[model samples]
Every structure is written in structure tokens, then in C-alpha cells.
Target: MPESCRSRELPASLLTNPEMVRACRARDFARVFRLVKVYAGIYPSMIARRCELTPSRVGEVMSGRRQLQHMDVIERIADGLRIPGHMLGLARRTWETPLALATDGRTTPQSVASDPVAPASLPGAEVDSILTLTSRTDPSPSMLQALRSSIEDYWRRDDQHGGEALRPAVLGQLRYVVGLLKENRPAAIRHGLYGVAAELARLTGWTYFDALQYNQARAYFTEALQLSKEIDDRQFMANVLACMSLQATYQEKPADALALVNAAQDEARAAPGTTPRVLSMLSLREAFAHASLGNRYATHASIGEAHRHFDQIQRGDTDPAWVTYFDEPKLIVDTGIAHGRLGEAATAEPLIAEALRRENSTNQRGRAFHAFWLARTQLGLGKLDQACQTATDALEPAASVASERVAGHLREFYDELAPHREEPVATAFESRLRVALPMRVSGSPRP
Candidate 1:
């Protein structure tokens, strides 16, 4: 068969699969390409040169030519585009399943636990729903406000119920909101929506990181940081920096994490009182960075500083628009988790348990994290039964949310129990852990 004709001979299954067709018909291919181009800025031409493809060829594939069916060719394009493997469907066939199942893949009940970056896979149904919503031109002001209000409600509810109970719902809402943002592209909406995009991107990175999808997570984080910067929101930028620091710590680069945290601290200091909540968050980041670096004294100092900032927040403190979500209890819970990471099980246990006790009054997502850390502390102390129970307890909340950071902690806890796989407590814990973790595409191990 002639090469050009051979492309035509390729099975429809290869080029016209539902996803491929959707990508083409919905113009997602072009959008994704454009996003990449915009993200690459001056480097798009440079990237094309290195890939031995003309800039026009790059445009052609992105513009949805029906003949681009070769997997190798798609991969090369993705590489040149700097698209994450998972997003490009190059990681595994996980996207074939529901988002929940994809999220729980290899870590199911029977399999040995593995780390996979488990970002909420954009389900076909969800994508269609988003498309339907976005297809409308000039969405009504009330409708746009309604969408924004709905997103705000998710954040508020997540804060109130704890992140766990509201995670899946929140993720669904976020995906919808992102679609709306893409469709509308209104400057006024973009001002606020940029922060939302950064948050979503951060969450996506965390999920991917937990699923051991480092490259994808990294890409998401990079995008998040850039978005945050574009908005010129210092607090959000600091949060993104803190997130990057956490990623560095998990990747076992404590120095890098510390550096990022320090940079965040500098940013936070420069803009004190501009966003007290984010500033408090930066303090927590400092604590975590110190903990990761094994600087016990510095960790304690940072935690104290965080606590002081928390104390300063009066009933009427003027918080930035983006940071209206945090409060004292949330700060305590976050600090507790950091202490746990530092191996201060004695200090961490009471604080975590307290956080869990009050979690019912706050966000389901935060509660899930508290539960995971409680389990980690228990595991550290060799309280296998308690650890198993706490770990199992964590799932109820975890299953409700879409944060990869929570999953990453669970994976670490699972690894901790692996050495004692013969013990009954460990066995039970392992079983539950598998259900929570599932196998990921990259097969990377947890820190």
C-alpha cells in the first residue's frame, strides 16, 4: 500500500475511535494545540524545529487532519507540544473506564499497591455535558453568575463538609466551570476564573502525582503556577509555589522543596495582610518544608509562626477574594499533617484526632486528609490495628473527593504496611489500601 493511502487503510478504530472523533468534532484538538502554543509562547517554533517538523505540520495535526492515525506520530506531536502523557492518552487505557474506576485502578482490593497519578479523567459524559454548556454563544450574565456561584458553593461546601464528602461533586463542578471558561473567555470572568483554573490545575497535579504520574502532575503544576502568575495574584502564586514545594518533597528533593517554600515565604511576606489565609498557608508550607528536610527545630518554629498568623485573624479581617476559605481549624489540621510528616507522632496524634473530631463541622476533603495522616501516625507507631482502622476510615471520605495528595498519602501508608503483609492488621489494611490506590499507568513508587 502506498504510504499516503496506507494512512487511509488504517482501521477506523485507530483514527475514528469515539475519543478521537470527539477530539476532532468538538475542536478539542485545535484547542489543546492552541493552549500548548500559548503556553509555549516563543518556544513553539523552537520545539517544532527540534521535532524535525515544520511549524505548519504542527498546526495541521492540531487542526484535526483525519489522516494522523499513527500512534508514533501522535506521540511525537505530543512530545513537541509538551502535552502530558496521561492527557494525550499515551499513559494507559485507564480512560476507557469511569473516572472513579480509573482513579482506583491498580490499587484495588487484590493488587499490590502502586502509585499512579490519578487526575480525574475527563469522562465522555462529563465532556459532553461541558460541551453542551459551552456551545452556546454569549451565555447570559445571570447564567454565568449562576455557574460562578455554583463553583463558589462547591468550595464553601468542601470547606464545610471537609473535602472528602464533597470531592467528586466539586471535581464535576470544576470541570464544568473550566469548560465554561474556555467557551466564554470573558475578561471579567477570567479575572476570577484564573484563580479557579490554577486551583483545579493544582488539584489535577496532585492527583496525577499520587497515581505516580509525575510528568503529568508536573505539567499541571507548571500550568497552575503560570496561571496564578498571569492573574497577578500574589497569594495564589504563593500557594502554587507551596504546591510545587510539596511535589519536590514527595519526589525526594527536599532542598528543592525548601527553596520553593522559601521563595513562597518571601512572596507572602511582601504581601502580608493582602491575603491572610494564603499567608497562613505559606507558613504551613514552610513548616512542611522544614519537616521534609528533617529540621525539627525549624519545623516547630514554622508551625508556631503559622499558629501566630492564625491567631491574628479576627472576626473582621479583610481577606483577599481568593482566600476566603481558610480559618483556624483548617490551619490546625494542616499543621497536624505536617507534624506527622516530621515523625512527631506524639504531637501529631492528638492534633489529628482533634481535627478528625471537628471535621464534621468543616470540609469533607480536609477530614479525609486528617484521617490519612492519623493512619500514617498510627502506622509509624506500629499501632497496626488502629492504623488499619484509620486507613479504612479514610476511604469513605477519600472516595468522595478527587485530590491526588490524599491518594499519595494513602499509597505511602500502604507501602509502610507492605513489610508486615503477613500480619492480620497489615493484611486488612493492605486489602483496603488496594481498593483506595489502584494501579496507575507509569508504575512509579511512592516516596
Candidate 2:
């Protein structure tokens, strides 16, 4: 086949999507065909031609009038769609041969999944750009900027949905960026590359953290800190420390969390690039630590300090790109979350509800996270019916959000409702939970 025809592969984002993966796993080729068209732009005629089926047959499958059951036909579909064999519960495809497992032939779905920086996952330009960066000693400014923008794009997708699907692409990008560091480049280019590498590592850590993979998250976070130090980027180091502190809090190590935050604050103080948003973010981390430890007075104090820093924000203040998400809605939500952590239901409930209303509509993960928190707070107030109602409302969005952290929150709410599981409201919510978040609800381990 011509390279163009052979290079035809599904988009990494689509294949890694939880819904698409589930649909494929269940051999729901009808849904798979629909999602492929939506996400990969492979229309029915194209799918028919590629998969060796009549367009009418493709239409039938997509319309649920037919199913692809024959092993031979299934293999054809797998090879045509470039879907991993494992996803469809089949042996590895013939195209994914041992030689094809090489770094050069990253066309294999496993490679596209584990390390996604290939023609399959990236655009021609991006593939060319990364190859240039890795294969040569010096890379162009434009290429560097393109890579930096891709990092920004990753964060945007992660915020709206969740980081689970983005992990492969990000880790691949991280590896490529880190590889660039070994090559000799101009001082400015090298410095910029370090920044990209640091941020990518941080993002990798965050993705692992979202999935509750603490050890992996910490390793990447620590690497991010070291990479920041390579460029003497103290501000980035501080940010990494803050991220570590947040993860520690989630790990139930509040004392460790507080110490990390203090170290982060010290780094921020030393770095002249620190902005109010950065300070506010660090202070919020401090608040989370105090709250987790049930230090009510200290939690309130740190949150107040966070607010003070937040109030100093001004337009065009030149805050780091990473801290841009620390806007009003975030601060408000964190305050409520801290209150909820301390079991202050009355104060937490209204604040979290209002914050949810003000949250960015595209942030599905945020919506699910806050809704779970609100449900927990309501449960604490003995409003079992209201709690179950809130959770029921959240179930749909939770299905779309692949955050294990959010799933853990859902599990927490379920465990909290255990005592009243026989209650009608709780029973109804339980049924909904089974449908929406079955795997997480069952206490299954994160992959």
C-alpha cells in the first residue's frame, strides 16, 4: 500500500476515549462505526471501502440492523479501522508484526496507545516537528512554539473532560521533549525546551494523579521538579511542589502535604516570577492540607490568605499559563471544598452549589467533582434524599468524565450512603450508579 493509504489510522484521542473503548470492547460495531465517523472522519462509504463491506452493510451496522460477527470479517474491520486487536478481544493483528513493533513503525495500536507520538496520533506537521527535534541538534523556534501550544491544548482537554485518555499522548510528548534536552542547542532554545519538558512531566504527573496512581504521579512530579531545576526555573519547581502537595493531601498525608506547600512557598518567594495567582494556588494547597488534617482554624486562616492573594489579581498581570485556571470559580469551589472537608455542611453546601453554577460549562470533570462534593456535604447534613438526588443528577456527567479521582469521590458518596442503602432515594441512586459508573462503584482497581 502507498504510505498514505497505509498511514491511515484512527485518531489517538478517539480510540483512547472511554466510551469508544467500551463500545469497541462490547463489539458494538454499530456504535463503533458511529463514533469512528464522528471522531475520525471515516464516513460510511470510506468505512465500507476500507473494511471490505458494502456501503449498505456499513449503514446497516451503524443503524443497528446488522452486526460484524464472523472472525474473518472482524479481522478485516480491525485491520481497516486500525483498532488494536485487544480492544476487540482478538489476538494481535498481523499488521502489528514483531518488526512493526520497532520505534520506526509506531503504527501499532499498542505503541500509539503507550507512546502516541506517531503519524497515527499526531499530524504530519507535528510528526515532522518532533522528528526534527529528536533527529537533529537544533530545532526551529516555530517548532518549539508548536510543541508548547500542544501542551496547552493537552491541559485544555484534561480540564474539560479528564486526563485518562490524554495520558499516552502526554507521556509520549514528555519523552520527546526530554530527548531534546540531550542534544546540543542554542541557549535560548535549550531553555525553552526545558520549560516544555517540565510542563509535560507535570501534566503526566497530574494525569496519573487523576487516576489515583500516586507512585507514578509522584515519580513524574519529581522528574518535573528536576527538569525545572535544569533551566533554573524556580517558579516551575514551586508549581511542581504545589502539585506534589496536592497529591499528598489526597494520599491522606496532610503533614507531608503541608511541608511540601511550605517548600513551594519558599521557592515562590525566591523566584521573582511569582504572581498573585501562583501565591493563591499555593495558599489553597495549604488550605487543603489544613482542612484534610481537620485543623479548622488553620484551614480557615490559610483559605483567607488565599483569598487575600486572589484579591490582588489584576488584568494583564502576566501570571504563568498553568495558574490561569485559578480564577474566581476555582477559588470559590476550593473554599467550599475545604469547608466540606471539615464537615461544615451548612457553610459548604450553598457555596459549592453557587460555585457549580458559575463553573465553566465545558468542565465536565469539575462539574462531576463539585457535584460529588455537594452530595457528600448534603449527606453530612442528614439530607439523604437531597444527597441522593444531587448524585443522581451528577451520574450522566460522571459517565463522560474519566477521572478516577472523581470516581473515588463517587465511591465515597456510595460508602456514605451505605447505612441507608435500603432507603428509597438511596436505592434509586444505587441503581443509577450501577448504570453510570459500574466499574468504579464496584471498587475495581484503576488501570
User: In angstroms, how far off is 78's CA in candidate 1?
Assistant: 15
Clashing residue pairs for model 2: none
Task: Report lDDT (CA) for all predictions.
Answer: 0.63, 0.82
Give the best candidate by TM-score: 2
lDDT of 2 by residue, 1-447 (tens): 433344467888998999998787556889999999898878887787677666666776898755555567777788888888767656667666454356555474353322222232223444544643564546679988998899999988997788877766676567667766765889999989999989998998998899898987898899899999998888889999999999999899999999999999999989986899999989988989999999999999999999999999888799988888888989998999888888788999998989988988888888888999999999999999999999988888888878989888887888888899899888888887777777664654221
Which stretches of candidate 1 lie above 4 Å from their native place?
Answer: 1-144, 153-212, 321-325, 361-365, 399-407, 418-447
What TM-score, computed on C-alpha atoms, does each candidate reach? 0.61, 0.70
Whole-model alpha-carbon lDDT for candidate 2: 0.82
- Candidate 1 weakest ten by summed lDDT: 2-11
Give candidate 2 regions above 4 Å deviation: 1-137, 441-447
